[model samples]
Target: MDYAFAGAMSGLVAGIIVCPLDVVKVRLQNQPPISLTNYNGTFPTLVRIAKEEGLKGLFSGLSPTILSYLCDRMLWFATYESFKVAISNHTTRKLDDPFVHSGSALLSSVVCVVGITPLWVIRTRMMTQNTETIYYYRSVSHAFKSIIKKEGLTSLYRGLIPSFLGIAHPLIQFPLYERFKIVISNYEHHSKLEDYNPNKRPELSNLGILTSSIVSKFIAAVITYPHEVIRTRLQTQTAPLNKNFSNNTSVIPNIVPYNGIVKTVKNMVVEEGWKSLYKGLPTNLIRTIPSAGISLWTYEMILNNMKNI
Candidate 1:
């Protein structure tokens, strides 16, 4: 219960702080291939959004983002803590072992992805909508209804495969965090390695948690980022209108809508080159590093306080 509460609070604060960067990242990722020159890059995209859409533009989809974070983080921490406890109790191995941590993170992520995917899809679509394009969603509830009515139930799960692939993120992140904790502990103890105690959770300093989270998240994000682009593209695709049906039949037939993971990857590479897979990496790193650091730090602090009380 305490873990779940702490996680929800951490996610809420982190989501709010990083929402503008998230908005920028999504816009960059979901931009049409031809419009790359218009947005140019991260700062230019931020300026464009602010100039054209006002300050509100930076916070688009904040409602859904907050809600998603609340539920997703709650479930993730609860399940992860539960898994760690179960693994420690059942196995002879230490709970802080790399494999144990990674396995727990992977399992927790699976459950989190399954439950929170639709909310994330809704958030992405809302964030990417702009005045230059036809608005697909007026609001979160409206988007949910419209997607169901127009695109069918399965549309909400469009990016599930790539999201599943994203499990590698926490697989890398948690293990690195454990390793960093070990290094910090050894350093503090004058070069003597200490075994982690499963019964007593060691309190990590704020700086240690922040530094570890930033390093781990950055590396995990860079390696796993292509899947993020694919997932956003999958979620934000809409059906085209027939306004240009009479203009050019050839163009109409050639318009490739985002399909599944493999088809989307093939089409993206063919149309925009392999570099397209990493379109919004800079903005994503900016958003994720601080957001992840603050979140982990906040989660640990809250959990520590709860344990003391």
Candidate 2:
């Protein structure tokens, strides 16, 4: 298979593997503010949801989640690789150098944001809606249709701004991972790793790569956390107000053109309170750490294989 296709497949597998956590994270983030009186911790909340909603609830938006993830990573890696190849024609530097890898990751993320936003909107909405009304979704398509029927097609793209902003996390981390790998390879003198094939075995002992991956992910998760909160808020299904001060009243979460990103931020802060802007932040960081670390590690491994092939 082609490298791009292989990356897509690997992303799909990773998406499926990690989706349960993603669903849980989304639910936690999109939920109404937790009453201090009601819950003890994140894990307990997760347990309560699983106990109440069952195992399937834990994997609620798996289909759209996987699709969006695969599509995003595929485009990201492909674009990154293509950029590296093009840059190679203009420079004599090694392709696996830290700069090259980081540059690729940054570039690829820009491409992915354009396409991935809609899918993410759908996934988050499905995950966070009231369970009773949300049950209309027999599958991913059904979920999407129900949203469109009631909310319009544009509803599926609700959090586009914050989501686009969130892409910077990957953009920052991927290149950082690339650079970290170089530092590791250099420290090991490259000969040891040269003989140990990534295709044949897991390279767990690559401390530099591991450390770099972990650090980069941690930094990225912290810096971009607000965007996660914003995206979740926008994507989450809202119950309609009993009365509308501005216009018609409805019993469903009606659409609001909160205008630009600034306006969106201001309205959310005024309407929901300042803390609501940071809703689900703790769950987001916890979820992002492992997901990002493993994904970056695999991306490097895949890139190494493509080079040798």
Candidate 3:
């Protein structure tokens, strides 16, 4: 099986299905810092976006998000497979070695972050801004050009630091996922994982993979979610709006541009409390838990069928 092809399909499926939820999550994350708008919960936020902005609102960043996943997952799985193969060959370690999974995923994440941060910056802007704002971007390419023109080339990689920090997510997740696969295989008395095979054992079925993905993803997400909020804020955040605007009648939350990660996080905690750091957690969980499971399941299914063919 072509790991690249399998990963690409997995990303496309997951990105499209979870995009609406992603918009909600970003809006929630972006809003709290400035008191722009308050979102109550996941379902409520989804309902509000649909009611006010319609389907287009829900899918605002669809193009960039889709492209992001396609490129990200293609690089991710391809790199992982290459790293896994190389490490196992050199060290004579089993393919399932924990270091193999963790190292591969972390390296793959770095590759994705470097390659894809600009897409994410564009996506965040598209999601948070409408036609009214100076930052609103119509198409992905327009956003790309506009950001560079207006804010300079570095703007496209605004949240790059936190994005690199986000590697911790897949590092924790893929390794734990591999560990879980080993557990399931052992539980079923099967020596090899069903990662690319569905007929070996019923215990290592789709359900097992799904469960592993959900548990690993959920854990990783919970631990790493604050970085997500910080990253979004940095990406969509506008320049410091009217330094003396605090004395004015109305003040926008985008008043402060998040500068460094530590300063931004410290500011969020001081101003909005620690909860602000986890602004979109519930929505994120709802969107991502199943999304991860589905992504892995899709990749494995594609790989399995392709191998059989």
Which candidate's TM-score is highest? Answer: 1
Clashing residue pairs in candidate 1 (N, C-alpha, C atoms within 3 angstroms)? none
Flag clash pairs in model 3. 34-253
Worst 10 residues of 2 by lDDT: 242-251
lDDT on C-alpha atoms for all candidate structures: 0.82, 0.65, 0.81
Candidate 1 lDDT over 1-309, as tens digits, reads 999999999999998998889999998888767663357788898888898889889999999999988899899999998998787677766777776798789999999999999999999888977665445566779888767765578878878999999999999988887778767755665554555554556556778788788898988999999999999888777544344332211111114588789999999999999999999999999999999998999999998888889
- Please give the lDDT score for candidate 3: 0.81
In angstroms, how far off is 111's CA in candidate 1?
0.3
- How far is each candidate from the true structure, as Cα RMSD in Å? 3.9, 5.4, 4.7
Q: Which residues of candidate 3, in runs, are more than 4 Å off? A: 189-203, 239-253
lDDT by residue (1-309, candidate 2, tens digit) is 355765676577668777766766666555443322243346776787688778777777778888987887788767877877666556765565556656666667767777677787777765654443423455677766666655667767777777778778877776676556655665566555455432232333445556877888887787777778667766764434333322221223424435556876786677668776666666666766666666656766776677678
Best by lDDT: 1
Compute each candidate's TM-score over C-alphas: 0.91, 0.77, 0.89
For candidate 2, the lDDT comes to 0.65
Give the per-residue lDDT digits (tens) of candidate 3, residues 1-309. Answer: 399999999999999999999999998888754453567788998998898889999999999999888888888899988888787788877677788778788878888899989988888888876434444566899878766655579978888999999999999999898888768756666554445332232245788889889999999999999999999988886444443333222123466557799999988888889999989899999999989999999988888888779
